[model samples]
Target: MQGNSEVLVIDDHMKRKQQVELLLQFIGEPCKLVSSANIGEVLTEQVAWRAVVVGQVDIGSPFELVSQLAGQYKAQPFLLIGELGDCVADLPNVIGSVLEPFSHSQMTQMLHRCQDYHLKAPSKTKPTSQHQEILFRSLIGRSGGIQQVRQLIEQVAVTEANVLVLGDSGTGKEVVARNIHYMSARRSGPFVPVNCGAIPPDLLESELFGHEKGAFTGAISARKGRFEMAQGGTLFLDEIGDMPLNMQVKLLRVLQERCFERVGGSTSIDADVRIVAATHRNLEGMIDKGDFREDLFYRLNVFPIEMPSLSERREDVPLLMQELIERLASDHKVTIRLTERALDSLMEHTWPGNVRELANLVERLVILFPNGLIDVNDLPSKYRHVDAPEYDHEYDESLLEQDMLNDVFQNDVYEPPESSMSTQLPPEGLNLKEMMTELEIDMINQALETTDWVVSRAADLLGMRRTTLVEKMRKYSLSKDSA
Candidate 1:
C-alpha cells in the first residue's frame, strides 16, 4: 500500500476530481492522488505513476490522448472517464473505463483493474537493432486488423504457451510466428519452419521426429528432424491440419510428454522447442469428421490467433502492394509503377489468396512491365470488372416464342434455315467431347494469360481452387510458355 506509488488524474471538472479522490479514499489505498487540469502539465512531470485516469473535460480527444500516453508508459495502466461511446476501449493498453457519474462499486472495480494491469504489464525496454528490423519486416500494415494482431503478438510473445495461427493461405501466418519467436526470450535460438502439407505423409513422421540410420531402406545417415533442429527455439508447423491422423496421435503424445524418440531409436530426446502451428484448413471440421484428433486440437489451440483475410483488411492492400513492389525492386532489380486507377483496381478485387496473391500479382506485373507504368487497363480483366466469370446468360423464353408467333402470323413466313436446331449437326457428326475440351482449354488459357500465369488468381477467375487449376493445367499439359 504504499510509498512512491501514485495515481495521476486529469479532469478539468472540480466535481469529477472530488469524486475520484473520494473513491480512492473509500478504497483505503495509501497511494498519493495527483490531479492535473492540463495533460501537458502531467506529462512534463518526471514522476513514476502507477495509473492514469483521464476524464472528458481534460482533453478534446480523450481516446487519442490515452493512446499516446499508453504508448509512452507501457507499464502504466490508463482509464478513460467519459461517455461510454466516446472512448475507444478496444485499444490494447486501455485496461477499462469509468463512465461519468459512476457508482462507488464501478469506480472501485475500474481502479482495481487498472492496478492489476499495471502490475502485470511488461516493463518497457528498447529492442535490439536486429529485433527492431525483424519486428518491422514481419508485420507491415497500418490496418486495424494488423494492429490488433501486433498487439496480440506483444501480449503473448513472452509466454511459453503453444500458439495456433488460423488463416487462409498467404495471410502471413509464418510471419506472425517468426515475429513471436524473435520478440520472445528465445530470440537467440533457431526458428525452424515446416510445411506439413508439402511433405509426403509417409516421410512426415521422420521429418518431424527424425529417423536413425538404417531405419528404412534409404536411410543412409542419421539426420536431426525439425523438432531437434528447433531446440531452444520455435518450430512452426505450417498447414498442421494436413498432418496424418497417426502422426497427430504421435504429436499429441510428444506434446504431452515433452519428449520423443527418433525412428528406430529407443532413446527419448527432450523437446525444448516452442510449438507454433499454422493452418489454412479448418481443424475443427477435421476433428468432427474424425480426421484430426480432438486431444491434439485442444493441445495446439491453447492460444489461437486468427489472421484476417485480405478481403477483410482490404484497406491495407495499397500499403502491402507498395511494400511488395519495393521488395521486388530490391531483390530482382525490376521497377514497376501502378497508376491511380490500377491501384484502385487492385484495392477493389477480392483477394482470395490474401497477401500471397497480392505479392504474386506485384511480381508478375514487375516482370511483365519492367520499368513501365501500369494503368487500369493493363490490370487483369478480373480486376477491371466486378464479375470476373467468363460466361453470362440471360434468357426470355416468352418473348422469343411471341416473336416467332408474330413472324408466322404477320409475315406469313414459315421457313426454317438449313442450320436450324433440328438439323444443326453435320453429316460427318460433331465430336462433342473434343469440342468441349477445346473450349475449356481456350477459356483456361485466357484466364492464365490475363493473370500472367499466377495460379491462385487464375483459379479465382475460373471459380476453382488453385490446386484444381493446377490439376487441370497438368491434365492439359499447359504451361505459361505453351500458352
Candidate 2:
C-alpha cells in the first residue's frame, strides 16, 4: 500500500459500495474500503486514508462523512465520489468529489485528481531545507504587488536618487528604505534612522543640524547632529510629515543646497547624506492646506516607492508565518510546529496591523503552543467560530473556490451570517456598521494620509470607484481629524 493508502466508501447501499470498489480496483488504486451508513461509526476509526468515495445519498450529512475522514485523516487528502448537490461542498479535507455511479474513466480520473490535490496540499509545500534557511530573509512575498515593490527596490537601489518610501505603519516602509540604501553606493556607510514625529520640535532642529556649544540650555558642548554623523551615508527620516513647519524650512534648505550648519555655528557643513523619508501621513494634503511646504514636498518626492500592505499579499501569509515561527522557535529555544488547521486560521485573519501584527501573533502562539502540536483548538476563541472562516484577500479565484469546496466538505455544515462576504472565519464580535465605518474611515484616512490627501489616490486606497469613495467620505462625517 502507498504511504497514504486508505479509502472509505460511505453509502447506505452496500451493493453500491461493492460496485465502486471494483471500479477503483480496475483503476489500479486498490485499497481497503470500509462501507458504512452511520458516520459516527466511520469516523471513530483510527486509521489514515487518502480518499473517501461517498455516495450521493450520504452527502446530506456531509460532516458525518467529513468528520469520519477528517477526524483521523484531517491531513490526508480527499476525493468525494457522489452526484452534484449530493456531496456537500462545505466538507473539510475534500480535494474534489465526483458524481455518483461513476464510469471507469471517471474513477481513474478521480484517483488522479486526488493525487494532484495531495501533491498541492500545504504539507507537501513545506519549505525545502535551503528555503527554510533563507525564508525570513527573502522579504516575504507571494503576490504581484510585493513582487513589484521588490523589483523597485532592486532597480532603485543601484541609483543615487533620493527615495520617498510610502505606506501605512507596520507595512515595512523602513525595510524597503534600508534595502534601497544597502543596494546603493552607500552600503559601506552607516544607516541612521530618525523618527521625525517622535522628536520634539526645538530639539529636532538641533538633532538634525547639530548645534554649536551654548546654542541652547542643554548645549553645554558642540554635538554632531544626524546630518553630520550620517555624512557619506544614508539618513532615514521616518514619519517626516510630523516635522514642525520651521524644521521643514531648514530641511528643504538642506535638500536644495545639500549643505547646512549647526544651530549656533556659522560654518555651513556639507550635507552629503542620502535622504530616504517615509511617513504614514499625507504630506501632499498638508501642503495643499498650507500646513506643509509645496516646494519641500516636490523635493523629497523625487523618487517615490509605495509599499503594499500585508492584506494585499495574503498569499505570502502562510510562508511568512512559517518563516516567523521558525525564527521565533530558534530565538526562544523552542520546537514549535503548527497543525495544518492552526496555520490555516492564522492565514485567514485580515491582519489590519499588517506584518507587524502577524509577527506578534506568531510570537504569542509560540509561547502558547510550545512543544505541543498547534492545532485549531490552540487558536484563541475569537477564531473558532465554525461559520466564519477567516478571509484572506491575497487568495485568487481558484484558491477561493477550492477553499469554498473544502469548507463545504470538511465542516459539519454551518455557515456564518451577517459578516462581510469575504470573511472566512466567524465574526470577532465587531459591530457591522461600526466595522464598516471604521474600515471606511481607515481607508480614507490612509489614502489621504499616504497621498497627502490627494483625492484621486485616496480614492484608489479605498478601492471604491473614486467618485463613490468621495461620496462616502462626505456621507460618513469623517475626516483625517475632527474639527
Candidate that scores best on lDDT: 1
lDDT of 2 by residue, 434-473 (tens): 7666765765776787887655566556544333454456
Maximum-TM-score candidate: 1
lDDT of each: 0.71, 0.65
Q: What tens-digit string does per-residue lDDT give for candidate 1 at 312-382? A: 77656655765676667768888776543365567678888888888888888897889776666777777
Cα error, residue 417 of model 1, in Å, equals 63
Look at candidate 1 and tell me the lDDT of residue 264: 82
What candidate 2 gets wrong by more than 4 Å, as runs, is 1-138, 383-483
Cα RMSD to the true fold for all candidates: 22.4, 19.8
Residue 156 displacement in candidate 2 (angstroms): 0.7
- Residue pairs in clash, model 1: none
